[model samples]
Target chain A: MKGASEWDRHAPSSAPNPRHTRYHPRWHRERIPIFWWVGHRRYTLFILRELTAVLVLYSGLLLLAQLVAIGRGPESYQAFQGWLAEPWVLALHTFVLLGLIFHTVTWLNLAPKALVLRVGKIRVPPRAVLVGHYLAWIAVSALVAGALVWVAG
Target chain B: MSPVAKGAGGRQGTEPERVTRSREPLLWSLFSAGGMASALVLPALAGVLWVAVPAGWVAAPEHGAMLAVAAHPLTRAAVSLLLILFFFHWAHRFRYTLYDGLQLYHLNLLIAVATYGIASALSALALWIVWTLG
Candidate 1:
């Protein structure tokens, strides 16, 4: 066998042989492109989370309008309903509802990461917060839906 | 600074001042969660409000309590405050939805401007209605 110095001088640390594996095939394949690697930027993520608030604002605005129309008179309120029932407005509302659902799911997922409230010395898990929010939303939604159905019945 | 250090020309880690409420993760999460909850609850409430008020099942309060508040100086100030905060909140949230949901990055700036502009206009309209009613 060659001495250490002699071996170091002649032998390559990275080998050319196929079995030697100077380059990893998996690593090369797994490497993400620069832009793709960014996935989504923080600013984008922040804005995405904020979509829920926008949805709330929009709903509030519409509700306020409905109230104002009712205040004006039944005819005006009926006219407002006619406008809302338009295909385009209904479509927009449907689209916004779907968006709100997505926003809710994402926001719930991030809640734990965003809030690390400790109950005494015990730290509350993020999942718990998410589940709580979802549960509350479901409960509130159900209550309103039930009331609507009851009234309609 | 090295290109590598600057996230390869991306924004630095520090959040912009206007958007920065604080770094408390719990508060941020709760706020976001609250926003989301409100998003869900408000729409459903709006539906109830829509049906009840029109069906004469429930009286619309905005015409009375809300309008009365609008008439008062203190309440008018409060209403304006709510409108502004709510508009900003809407803008802050819509900016994100547009950025992520729509793959139309080419139209990102337009979407941002439109979302915010519409929200501001709507808030203004709400204020206008309140003032007129009051």
Candidate 2:
């Protein structure tokens, strides 16, 4: 774009060079504002999806803390459980649950696009992919719940 | 003036150019695995731990049983993998969030380092906790 205007730029377009093909970027994206995602519904949902990364990150850390508490002994573990029982913790978990559920639903919807499955010759349909994700989610969730309940009993 | 191509060696006065192999694919794989794992099981786990058990909607598992399960080598390994994948997922998502949402591409390298650094550090912590448990 820089040198094209001053010279015979149409030379390449009109009579293409068989040997060399010079490349130039055609699309120029405009600068966006910092809070660009705040206004639109779709954009806002994207932001929420991205923010769930933080939720999961903290959740990982909390799991680590629980493990450490477990290693510390029963008394320390009880204290950790007691700490979680605090009203503020529950309130925080309320939002955490919402954000994580959003993450799950949205991520599952994207499974079809990400995973292009095929059995031998025929390509798997996107609907099947979506259904498979939901089914897997349900199965895994049930497995975790069942494991915990089994341990309790 | 005739069109001249730039040299592959970079500028005359600048430092020597370095060929970089991007680790994007590997990071994305981790992110994908993490996203899937978290999405599948996190809601139920979070509900059980942070809400149901804490809020008294459900009974908590016995201490001995929990300790026994956590002590198991299989459980420890599974948890370690989960934590590592989860952290990488966070790193990738948060990195892009800052890149696109706030348009902070100028600090691209720094943001990348910081986000992945946190992930790596926390992953080590998670591993240590799991290894030392039970």
TM-score of chain A of each: 0.61, 0.79
The candidate maximizing DockQ is: 2
Q: Candidate 1 residues A1-153, lDDT tens each?
A: 768877555333332321232344663445333334145687456555555576667666775676577557657756886676666776677666666666666656766787788999998877788788778778878876665444444
RMSD of 1: 11.7
Which pairs clash in model 2? none
Which portions of model 2 show Cα errors greater than 4 Å? A1-29, B1-21
True contacts kept of each: 0.30, 0.78
Error of 2 at A152 (Å): 2.2
Residue B108 CA displacement from its true place in model 1, Å: 14
Assess the local accuracy of residue B134 in candidate 1 as a C-alpha lDDT between 0 and 100: 37
Clashing residue pairs in candidate 1 are A47-B96, A48-B96, A50-B93, A112-A126, A114-B25, A115-B26
The TM-score between candidate 2 and the true structure equals: 0.83
Residue A104 alpha-carbon offset, candidate 1, angstroms: 2.0
lDDT, model 2, position B1: 12
- The 10-residue segment with the lowest total lDDT in model 1 chain B: B9-18
